[model samples]
Target: MKVKSFKYLLTSISVLILVYHLINMFIFWPEIPERIAIHFTKGEPDNWGLKYFLLVIPLIGLFLWWLIGLLTKHPEKLNYINLTEKNREKQYTMAKEIMILMQNLLFIISIFANESLLRYAAGMENGVFIFLSLFLLAVILISLFFNLIWAATLKE
Candidate 1:
């Protein structure tokens, strides 16, 4: 996909996920206990805190979305080991694409985490959350590696 179109798609998905999270928070708020799971070990709650702490995930997601959007607009400011006059534009485009992908994946992760927290608070298991987390992490790492290699090895 073209960078512009891909960026727009990511933005739309992020916004939708954010809105969904907000709605879920509102719907689930009444059912959440005074104290909820804030941390997990072996898929079990290990740390507990006030339900309000759940807001942190969505807030972090918003901040990251904005920061990544800013970075996407100015990829030239990003550090690069292979930057040169011949490859600058291509590298910048690649960087922007990578930033956009990362932002989307991270936003999804944040939403999943928030949902997992809610589920845990309701005494539910999060096996799917754990699996999705691992899968997304692999995707992010693999995409980063290949995209960097492609940019670094660019000709003309």
Candidate 2:
């Protein structure tokens, strides 16, 4: 797919994921315990809070989605170590792509975290939550690493 189209696709998917998370939370709200597990360590719940605290997850996700979208609108404001007149446009495009990719991955992570929290609240163990979280984090870091490298090496 073309670059612009790909970016839009990612943005669309991110929006969809956020919506799904919010709806899921709403649908399952009644089932959550009065005091739910809000934090986890090593796949185990460590911190607990009122079930209403669960709203924070999707709210944060929504805020981040909006913030990232706004930030990408002014790519000129993005910092680039090797930005120059000749390569300025190319670098800006790369920076925006990186931001979009990060946003998408973050949304996915947020959904997973929400699911993990809900499961914990229900007194269930999701053994794979930690592993999946780590894997997604690694993917984000690696993608950023390579995208930055590519942006740095861009020619006029």
Which numbered prediction scores highest in lDDT against the true structure? 1
Off by over 4 Å in 2: 128-130
Output the lDDT of residue 130, model 1. 60
Q: In model 1, which residue pairs have backbone atoms overlapping below 3 Å? A: none
Clash statistics: count for each candidate: 0, 0
Over the stretch 1-156, how does candidate 1's per-residue lDDT look in tens digits?
A: 599899888788878877886887898788889999798787667898999889988888878877887898889889886678988888888898999999888888888888888877766676787678678878999999998788667775
Clashing pairs in 2: none
lDDT digits (tens) for residues 1-156 of candidate 2: 355887889878767866776786777777887998787677566888998877787778778877887777788877787778988877878778877877777777877787678766766675576567678889989988998788767666
Instruction: State in Å the error of residue 101, model 1.
Output: 0.8
How big is the positional error of residue 7 in model 1, measured in Å on the Cα after superposition? 0.7
In angstroms, give how far residue 40 of model 2 lies from its true place: 2.1
TM-score of each: 0.90, 0.84
Looking at model 1, residue 106 earns an lDDT score of: 87
lDDT for position 121 in model 2: 73
